[model samples]
Target chain A: MRRRLKSAVVAVPVAFVLASGCQKAAPPPPLASVVVASCAAIPAAPGDPAWDAVPEYVAVLIAQDLVEPRLLRLSTPEIRVRAVSDGSRMAFRLAWTDDTRDDLPGPAEFVDACAVQMPRVIEATVPAPQMGETGRPVDIVFWNAAWQATVDGRGDSIRDIHPYAAVDHYPFEAASLQPGSAPQQEMATRYAPARAVGNTMAGPRQSPVQDLSAEGPGTLSPVPDGHSTGAGRRTEAGWSVVIVRDLPQALTSQGDSQVAFAVWEGGHEEVGARKMRTAWIPLKLEVKP
Target chain B: MALAYNWQIGRSMSYWYPENRPKRQFAAVFDINKCIACQTCTLACKTTWTSGKGQEYMLWNNVESKPFGCYPLAWDLNLLQQLGAQQWRGKEYAGRTIFEAAEAGERVLGWRPADLDYAYPNVGEDDCTGRVDRGAALRAPHLNWFFYLARICNHCTYPACLASCPRGSIYKRPEDGIVLVDQSRCRGYRECVKACPYKKVFYNALTGTSEKCIACFPKIEQGLQPQCFVNCIGKIRLAGWLSPPERARADNPLDYLVHIRKVALPLLPQLGLEPNVYYIPPVHAPDEFLSQLFGPGVPAAICTYRKGPDDPDLAGLLGLFGSTDRVVPRWRREDDWVAALDEDGSQIVRVPLKEPVYIREAFDAQHQVTRTNCP
Candidate 1:
């Protein structure tokens, strides 16, 4: 069961533990803000043209694998985020440290993934950051390492993974219509049926970073929008990703909105409900003078 | 999960809860000799349930051409290979039952099959072991043999699905031992999928959850048969309450076929899950092959099915096939017909020893007479 923050008590136990005996109580979560520069100011390539104007907010997020928690830990739950929005588009650069690099999901195992969630609400009353509530939807940009590997042309094909495994024959892959055509995979013919069956093969040229929408738990679905874009590169520490989309209509010359974030370390076999997450945080936007 | 000594495997296996047996346990039997792989049962099941978005690849009930066919490609062959070979001494298994197969740190006894493995519904349909050993004489028209083995969730007496689910998301109904995955509670770990040797449990990618055949509880509660049971064109499937091993009934139809006559046996009984679905082995198939699939009941079941016409009691049981849509909990031999009764002694069916001379749907309830004074 997903427990929502009651607006009073949140996960501040770790913070409280560190600052005990000090006169001043634990400090509030750092605010993340950015100045929207001109579109020309942003570079074409990923991890390029560093913007010193964007304030990098290093904030801690409390994560627990409460859903049938076993060996996997919700560790390294901290993210350094910097945001910006040109007159036409919005963007955020996020970085987090993870020990082992997980780039495969296979006959062996899972890939690392990161996502950013926004309430999709332009103006008043922030929706519950726990992926939003009913009637309120959260638009998400999810970047999976496996999809990225496909983009980089580095992922192995199904046959490549299991050499000894024989695929003798697939009726769907057969040419010249056979006698009994079948309860056909009508849509599947468009894509290669052999690889199409698995979940990992998202789609061809279909963004490595997918746009999804969710309203509360179990209400997640891929949003049809292809406008949102993201790019990421793995460093020695972990991963640094840039998620960008059209600027929200609610954003005036200078305004702020709440956004939520989640990350999954696939090497630990984390997926679905097993993830590291953060509550609603402010993301300020401005057209820098 | 709990443990029980399954002497059939000479080891303890994950068993249903203690003292958890309901007033009556639901049992089923499929006469493989009658099935023609028509797929009516599959359609009936698919149309009734499992037609949703993520369920496109799922078949709650499936018919696989044996020897070279399996719905999830090689679900049976793969598991068997993983289990390797085990010796069977007469009636008991001398090797591991998955539970004992697990090494030091592993929690599960079986393997996790990737979703890609379950991609095609019938990977090798009707593909025979060989196109017949042509060198041999054509004296036997049936040479390279293949039989249709209809399968469904067995709703085992001890469900591996129930045991492997960490959050206790899977449960066996005490009323009928119908194994079910709690959709609301399932977090989609697919542990049940891995633990189930039969690969009956399926993971719904869309819902991010797991689902399985429910055994049609609503219909069962209403005294109607499951869709697969009533829709079977071959008239092979029978559903009713089976008596527990300790309280074996000599009169009940299920017990008559299983315990009393010993002509119908549980599929893979040595697996030790004690699958509730029983089968009368194919008569013409290789005894060694049938033995592996149905255990020591192979020769005996084949003998009884082949000479069914000679035995009055066996003939009476055979007459009940495709005759009724209600569950027959208890049955007895009457003067003219074999009377099958429900829990309250209501006559669900009465099949005569011989077909009527004028055949216009012989099981007409309006003209059917009930033995009101039957015990």
Candidate 2:
């Protein structure tokens, strides 16, 4: 059934437009569709050869200045998106330009990040792009540069962040308690309360991408037992990140979906709702016969 | 947005949420005139909480000398400059609050301090205003003056930090009104750190979460004062429950001092957070600066505070400060003894209204030696 839908998607015509004008040119018309090409296996990295075969959709980014705590300035002007699916899973490769690499979290510092948002349930009408409206929920896969750094061998320990920090001792590291013992784990949890409480943002990172679901603004929450996987690399001029998640079952039958993108430039102090974002873009899933 | 009544501003101001007051509000009164800047409270808080890896720079309780001193350097001056011309019409504030002054698409008018800002927690420590001339004589209201402003989380009635958090991770405890950040829910956004005018909310880099003075809720739950309050060397702090002005009781120490006696005032009341921590304005500081810091209540509060022995009720209530480690919900002055009481009207502690003075003879005839330091 999935293979049948793959061939059906290829039959759909691709609409591509090029703008040519004087010094002052009209803004390019919004990209008609983001084509999700089918492949034997979804790429796990942006540099993978399979992504090269996929069409790139350049989405214009606008500052999120529509609500309270909004971004007043635009930082990431545009993002290039490429996506592919391998029968059971879907992956997106996002690349954007950022001058500085901000991966360290500090008192006032924010980390560079990007997110791919899709409606939790596909319906006749697309959900609102602003994190979806009430009742209409969206699933978001958020990747952070700092988390990527942690996963890429940079230590998540305090000593790694503050090399000169001196400490007499931590009760959790006491000699009496055996390493990895229940008592030691309990003591460790006492000090790292956020980690003990299962805050995904705290503690060590297994993957850079976090799965979240939101009903509307201020409702973003981590999805339990999320299986998303991603990797991000810092290129000379910017960052390229690949995020993978299980393919939505509805796409196999409908062959159509919608996705939105948001980017945060840590150097520009962008985080939370203060980010550059795009409205919902049409997504077509290609099937292979 | 909802209109919440801020007693400090003496008006209903713009707030993100409706006025949902707690069952009981945690409050404290700091007698600024008595603070000697010993930093015992600072150390006490440090030793109790915030002693972890990423909390090296965190000071849940800090003492900064006013006029020239600031933790996170100029946490107040920066916001004050932005708020612009804080005006007062008697007890009513005529100026825009941080909420009202919020820019387009912003929750509160606030600024986040840079990482280096926390580097100089003791910047301008002990620095005084106006140079003392060569022949400057001792006088009431001295020319050069500075006071130690010991600060903790205000646990505000309308916390700007709580209002600005997009995740709703920060909340005011409906039981005691202690504002806190839910560690599990926080995504290290630091929106609270940027929105708090007092800069009490701190971002812990390692944990990737914001931490603040829990108001020592552990102790509060046990019916004891916070570590800072119990360890204060100056005996200038009194922790208690505060009732709203309309429901204020004369016997309630916080209400008596803040509402009835009006001897203690909230810091930067014009910002409109309705900060719970109250200060007895420094009696010697100039009115201009004091008024700006404590709102229009400065002169009156200082006046009432200076009426020292004459105002027995106020004097006795002050004597109750640091009299016990237990939280004082009710108090009374009977004859020469002032007593601190619990919620059920049982005495927690008591102290004499006046310290018994003793006069020692210069000649120690009994010991056959002269007492050099005695009068």
Candidate 3:
């Protein structure tokens, strides 16, 4: 029920509360201006991709508990993605729908994924840059269809394809690479674990000897909780390695800067669990007004 | 009114001890259907209780959408699967039952990684420090069949936080059944943080004390809803006093809380924390879809509800509709673990379910069907 309060009635009660509830009139406190950073100042790194293709067709892999793998174009169908990272925790929500909610039971059930499908291609405004900073944290939420396709104990089903998107962008420090956009095969491989998880339909089952080192500059550290550790450092090649429990806490800056590590209650165990990682690029601190 | 005056007359009264308790119980009915994912509840909690330093990541009131949701990132299912379907009948949260004790060969009461910051590292901060946004995307869908679980301290009937705390910093108030983390008395040993399966207890590095959702005692004491509820844009929440101990249903898990739709449920009752927060099943999705969101045995669980003609199981079907109803069901909702064993000696209530029978609507609209309570 929407209750639109009349101005007169609302004003009377609000005024009364202010007038009677005030124990004493207090002076206003000094104001503090939070410094705003510029996204333009931090340009993208070299060898960045240009938007030559207006609607770049990219294939993303989707993963869930257990289901077969498939690829969906990100362009034609709407690509929906969500990333949740509350410092200690991080995850991506991804979904999409076809021109018709044909497979949908109804609008409510149809609006979301209830069956397995392929990865989706989305038309996005990805900027050209080797890598640039956004002046804020960027949540990288990836949804793999396979992850969703897997069935639950109650045999609940989900759409096959997965989508990942960033919530917000912080500062991005791109690693220098040979001039070329990420190849379709390489991009697909990056999402191999998600594909595996969905294909197998086994929840959070990572191979014991899983090698998560290829994802980025990081080593997985096991927290007091059983979840895997997502702490690591980058080498000169920009490759990341997991931070061992016995590793020295402080790091020495390499070519650009040294990566520091902090752990929290969030962690995961899976071959693809290492896919979730947030990187901090090193920039020489310069004094500015 | 009389109880208020009586408490005022004796300001120093203590109700923490299990004995000498009243006959009332406290429960929370979370209309998963009404959760809008505004995060106003999450942030309201941050500003009120967890805004302190080191507690930055601690979301005492976190809302996670099912199917692909994870707080510390797929924490529970990952470990639970690893533990291989081994159910913890009593106080133990599912997973490897024994945690490593710093004292050699001496098993500590309860400790797990989900409670501490050292478990999950912030690769975003480490990689980009000031510039690292982790490049991760976080979103909550609207108008879809997603459920919003705004979690705080459950203030359990028998708190794991209280039992596991070596220093005894965590205590459940007898007066209103609100659980609190007494900062002044805490040593940051973090025993309570680990013991709590829900992972509500947190260690604030800046304050060097264990912190958690206080159940908003200050607001509760004033007869008002917590900040999260008052400021919730969706109006998907309801706040009220629960039944005190003696008045609670004999051996009925839901007797202590409000809004147990004979079919309403708790997540992973097998872990045995006796969580006070309860949920109404979202049945709009297919039975299979409902199971994934709720967990493995959801379909069978939903079938236990009795339905009548024209009843869409509105109370049972929450979360997905984006409507947070504060409605309570007529029949006493049962706890999932009521039939299981209680290992650690934590008191567990046993409420048996009627034969699994699903109540359907007399007229089935394409959008909804009636809920049937199992008789």
lDDT of each: 0.70, 0.89, 0.36
- DockQ value for model 1: 0.05
Tens digit per residue, CA lDDT, model 1, A118-193: 8887667877776677999988888877666666775333443334445443434456545445534543332232
Clashing pairs in 1: A36-A286
Candidates, DockQ: 0.05, 0.53, 0.01
Q: Model 2 residue A177 lDDT?
A: 88
Instruction: Chain A only: give the TM-score of model 2.
Output: 0.87
lDDT of 3 at A276: 20
When 1 and 3 are scored with DockQ, the better candidate is 1
| Candidate 2 regions with alpha-carbon error over 4 angstroms | A1-31, A166-171, A174-182, B129-142, B357-375
For residue A134, model 3's alpha carbon misses the true position, in angstroms, by 60
Best by lDDT: 2
- Which prediction has the highest DockQ against the true structure? 2
TM-score of each: 0.61, 0.91, 0.38
Error of 1 at A184 (Å): 24
